[model samples]
Target: MEEHCLFYLAALAIFILMLVMTFFISSLLQTPPRRHKTASLPLPPGLQPLSVLGTFFALFRRSEFDVEPLLRRLHSRHGPVVSFRLLSFPRPPIFVSDRVLAHRALVGRGATFADRPSAIDPGLIISSNRHNVTGAPYGPVWRALRRNLATKVLHPSQLRVYSPARRQVLDVLLKDLETKSSGGAAAVVVMESFRFAVFSLLAFMCFGERLDDEKIRRIASLQRELLSNFVSFSVFAVYPKITKLLFRSRWKKLLDFRSKQEETYVPLIDARRNLLLRRQRSEDGFVYSYVDSLVDLEIPEDGGRKLKDGEIVSLCSEFLSAGTDTTATALQWIMANLVKRPDIQTKLYEEIERVVEKDAVVREEDLQWMPYLKAVVLEGLRRHPPGHFVLPHTVTEEVEFEGYRIPKGAVVTFSVAEIGWDGAVWTEPMEFRPERFLEGGEGEGVDITGVQEIRMMPFGVGRRICPAMGLALLHLEYFVANLVKEFEWMPAADGEEIDLTEKVEFTVVMKTPLKARIVPRKRT
Candidate 1:
């Protein structure tokens, strides 16, 4: 009787798979009547043009979680811009690796390509039904959210108001590293320290107060849990009405995680609201926070109602995760590279020493006079962008791009790492050479925003570019400068060299977390 039940379950799964495959194939084979004459143009080239079955199987064979390798192969086979579809997907996702084409689509026709794809079940649930900035559609709500962050929180003047928080976090990081390093007698793994430090800083900025270590750790764990399982949760996004029943366990787990996240975050949101109502400031004075902005914001598109607790939680989650993971990942890669190449480290240290006083911490303003420091940060971003691909974008309407027709609602993405490594733009793009950005170098005067031409874009480009770009750059420059100034990073005492091999997590990070023997710099 048990064996019969097992067989029936297996059969049901197979039948469901076949049904999904058939539905996708029929959709691909069916041609809808054209609404415009431009619709006659050919679609971008794809990997398997022979049949829909071939394309489905080809995509199935590739790892669904890691699409970089598949995208590279597709681009090599079919020029820079290519499209691929998996079973049950509504549209063929187009990928562009060519810089010129990326510029044309993302910048030249910025507004047309500014919109994001429809949010899936997990994203919708976590983002409070697509109310947050990242998941919100490109329109009035998106504009309001993005503007609030840019003008109220992330603006330069606003960022400077948080200097005390930055210094406090820096001191905490230094103390933690000092304890772990044990006066240069011990080797330390720095990624955890990097992550916690950044998380603490962002938490302070989010909550308007410095949270206790336990609270910070709890928040960090919850955010990391979401990011670690984010890729696996994609399964629930497909055919959600059916997947919720088929994968009931996973669906339950996602719901439980969201519940825990809300439990952890809502209290802080309420505290901020209460503080605002009391109209009182702590002894340190009123420090504006991201949540404060969210709480006070009135969405004109949504009948001018203020954000609810759940929506605030979602935005705060985005703020903590985005700022923490990406910045920490970049920090690890930069420090690891410095460990591997001491010559470059020495050059950077000398530059820092020249600009900063002896025994003094590297300040945000000092970052400007140090050109070599800027080059090193730029090199780190180019050599190891935290994310290999930007968030997927969709076209607002059917449009002609690069002599091919992109239908309305088609999913579009760009190969960020590939564009930054384009050989035509940078000489020996694979090498970690900061001189490439120095005067008389090939990469000098290169714009990372992809405005004039996309030599490299670590934070993406165009109208929908990362609103936190300025703040992120400041964090990188400030932290990298101080870290190099604080210690001379060296390979671990075990005689093993620093491993730069990357592993993709929430962001692409060093496979082997950077283990370095850090000797405190003896400044005058």
Candidate 2:
């Protein structure tokens, strides 16, 4: 009886200790008490101060598509620069709409704002611990990856080498469109075809092999699934530990998606590796691919360790994804505009006829001679920039910009849509007029790169400007010229108009996908 009493007392003591520990941990996990705003440097006006719970609910109330419009309204009301914080997000991103100030933040003092946000999000789950270039921390590793991408994948010379591959993909795309749009008058959705074409092109460049239509379609489907989930809040992004402990279902779904990605990507990576081995052994002339270049690349930061298979897979995924979605979405938007404005389409077609040979494929080299084509693409990018906000940038050190003090560790993103359509920069910015880029026009001699000054930055500017800008332009220009050259794009039957309403997923795309009645244009 005495021993039993002692055992009960020890058990009770242990239970009480565990309860205290649990309470302490819960308090720590809950949002910390809000920090008072700096007295000297006030954040730009937006979002009234609210408690953590209040802020989370209020901030997330707007859908992702609505977020940009809301910001634009705020910018008009509260000057060009605006800052807001959410209880859930540790650092609030300051949205900059003023062109000169944006240039200063992104280019003039770029290194200060060069780092990507250190967010624990689902989007980064497959980034090979941020080994790939896009999300890698600004350092030696990033430099090495960027250098490799610039030299091996995105260089002008490398693009020249890939011209044949581009032509082949374009041919495949044309054939697919012809078959799909064969039904008379009734329009078919072309977004899927565009996506397949673009994804296949990037996939070929990455893996160094052409896949069958079915296989390519399968890969595209899997990638879309992954990308959709990537942007959504998931276990990996928020409450990482709790997700594992209690949200097993969400955790399992992520794992399954990742597994599918691996299954699709790993084999392609292996095949590419084998191709490299064969090329090394044989005396045959070899063309280098993105994977081939990555295989040869040695990371100085990792003690000259060559990238592993998983890392290769990650890089290839980024390559496939970045190239596919953005270009495809842009293609749809540009084509939608063409369908909506037949006059513009007619002018574009007339220019193509003047420039190119009858019934011939559009080549990358020919793009230089065609300024109107360039302007049309420029206008498409301007009116509907793929992303409303450039990826959020973290300030490495505290710096003042245009009399506003920016604190270190703050997230900053320039408003691509706002800046593109700034009335001060472009007259009638909302109107889609490619002629604006012609000589003596508002955008004439404008520099897309913010090097001289940022007039418009659809591809972003400065140290973090997209390395693939050149390749992307080539894709857009080449495909747009060809698709217009082949087909007379018209609006769908029975008063169905092109809906320009955008919905943000992996990229901002038309809320209602463009379905166009297309007929093969007669060539003389």
Candidate 3:
């Protein structure tokens, strides 16, 4: 799912050949580094290195498609802390999954570990660079960008102000569902529908302009096409140079796409800029959305010039992307689990019914009274994180953990999905038990912040956590509350079993589109 290998293997192979040539040309011209004293760490004697490269050969042996299994193998063999070399690139990065080590990498020794390595999406580097919060490395600039997002865009007040837009989109989604259900059986590719809903809401919220279904779908499709380019799980962000060679054709296409995407963004960016200029002059009562906030503020760090159009556009791109696919994919996964468990769905519906009378559509105003609805949503995030792996964090210095050495510049990643399913961490890890989130259960309203211990980091943790998380959760809660309250969902006629196989792109997605019958709730 991550690497749609069949679609672009030939192109990737050619790129690999090209990259191999490049590597040789560069290696021959550049002088090799002089040998140094063996870097040793205080470690338990039992641990032994299989080779000078530690885990390199085995990792290199596996193809790009083998990443997950490769990670699993290293985790199993090396016990959470593993080291390997990037064949094409010069970095000898390590991967860690131990909770403590991961926390150390992300938070405890934060600054030393914060800079995100540049990946192949030159668009990401050239367009976004450090100006955009999402791709910027950790420092004064990164903090400034993130601080801006928090204060100007992601603040609670901002979320509350945009509540109407979210609820309106949820309303639209429900109405669409009603139309679809009116037909005999709804072959709800809930994934696509969910993506559309999230993107539509994000596009509206970010730009303050509601796009039609076709327009929103085209943007969503382009985002998807771009996301599918690398396909190699987590490689694009961590070991992109090597991954770039593997996905060479895609790299070129991404280059072209970056230019086109920037072009497409120009009109929207200009419209928002013009509107903001007008709103600021008029003192409109309506508070600015993210794009508006971006346009109004000067990037103090960047020569005190007004934010560049390309930079502002990149910020908006992050708003659309971070807000859309991840949340929508999570919504689909939640629905899949909810659809599979009729009892859970019934309990959720009953709770909503008690909170808001039958024939009453669930509204944001009514959410505070419906605890079960909140629990169901949390359970969904824990059960099926859209991004199974959070974007990778590279280590800045050598560190020792659990009697093992984590050399400097290792690429560290946390398994958000694995944490949710760790039996030791979550009881009945595989079961779709929303009750786990109920008042007295093991997962009783656990703070989703992931600060203390990683109960679940579905939206990620520490500095690298998704900035749009609160908005995403709000979107999920409101949408799920309405959809479940309005319909008693059932499996399609062909079979009773609810298949939940994954077909990943940017986010892990359901392979078999969730097709089901939605009998309307009893009218008043």
Candidate 4:
């Protein structure tokens, strides 16, 4: 009986495999239809002119982590726009790298191009299939969620109220740095410290309570576990029905991670809720927080339904994860650049010193006075954005740009790295020169948002632009200044140079974590 059962199970597995292969072959032989009434126009050039299945199989040979180099090569060989078809996908995703084309697609016709991919959005899973700002379809739900965050949590007034929390987190970061760099230790890994700093700050804003280091670190670890598993075009990129049936383990893993996250997040969220209720009864005021804002928001589209606890948890998790990793990764890259080039570091340090006393803490208000510091941050983001592409955008309707047709519900991504380093936009796209942003320089008055023209869109542009752009910029500026002011960052003393090579995780991070020597500044 056992032998018979084993034989039947093995045969069943073989049957499923054969069915999938047969479907793939049949799809490959069929010609795809154009979105418009016109005959099929030529797609932007890529590896080969294969049918959808062949293209997917060829692309599948490259792992999720390996897409960047492939994309770079394709953009080099092909023009600004490149297209690739996926298995069973309705349309091929078009990647745009040209500034003019990007501006045209992402900004000029923002509305038509603003919707997210309708099928199997990874964020929907991560967000518990609730109304998440990043992954929700462009509609009344997304608009309401985004507006709540924008007006209540990320507004200038709200950020101002959270300034004290930022300061407290900065103190935690400085102490950690001090402990690591003390006793003439070897170069310390900067990424870990950077992660702790940013995560701690976001946690405070999200929970409306200052968590101890241990609790915050636990949450950070779990969140990283979830994000590290989520690579672009991984299992979630496929059709949802097939993914659920065939890739059930992946879904299970995501749920397990979400479970672990809730274990850490639920208490905090409930505490905030109870506190808000208590305040309502006792008439006691409290500082604003992201969760507090979320709790109070009533969705008009959903018949004025308030957010559920699980939805709140998902939103808070997204807030913490999104804000922490990207900011931390950008901070690491910027600091690495400074360490790699001491001349730039000295110029920034001098500028910082000139603006404020040596012992003074760099305040948020003081950032504007330092042009070199601002230039350094901009240069870092330009050279190495946290992610090479923004979250994949979906077109709500058929659109035409520069003679190329974009079908409705197709995925579109813009290459941030390619555009930022385009020689046509910058004098030397590869060089790390902050002075380019000064008067009469090629990058003078450069707009990070490509509203006017997409010279370099690091944080993206148009209606779908990162809502936290202002806060992200402030975090980068504040931390970079303080770190530079606190220590004279130097390359590792053991003849090891700063490794600028990037490996994508949740963000484009240093392949070799940044470890650098630190000499405490006398003023610090």
Best by lDDT: 1
Candidate 3 lDDT, tens digit per residue, 53-72? Answer: 33333443333344566677
Model 4: pairs clashing at backbone N, Cα or C within 3 Å: none
Candidate 2: residue pairs that collide: none
Per-residue lDDT tens digits for candidate 4, residues 1-524, read 99978975675466447647866897889786644753265555665545544544453344543666777788888877888755444567888888898898888899988898764555666676757888778888889999999998899788987888888888878877878888336568878888888998888888777889889888888888877777533655544555455556777777787778778788887888888888763454456788888888887665779988778888888898889989999999999899889999999999999997888889999999988888888999999999889889988877666667677777899888888989987988888999998888888999887889888888889989999999999999999999888888887785667778888677888999888888788843
lDDT of each: 0.86, 0.80, 0.70, 0.81
TM-score for each predicted model, relative to the true structure: 0.94, 0.89, 0.84, 0.90
- The candidate, 2 or 4, that scores higher on TM-score is 4
Query: What is the Cα root-mean-square deviation between model 1 and the actual structure?
Result: 2.7
Per-residue CA lDDT of candidate 2, range 307-413, in tens? 98778877888888888889999989999999999999999888888888977877777789889999999999999988888888888866666656667788888
Model 1: residues with Cα > 4 Å off, grouped in runs: 1-31, 49-65, 88-90, 281-284
Give the TM-score (vs. native) of candidate 4: 0.90
Q: lDDT of candidate 4 vs native?
A: 0.81
lDDT of the structure predicted as candidate 2? 0.80
How many clashing pairs does model 1 include?
Answer: 0
- TM-score-sorted candidate list, best first: 1, 4, 2, 3
| Candidate 3 ranges beyond 4 A from true positions | 1-38, 42-64, 88-90, 121-126, 230-252, 279-287, 300-302
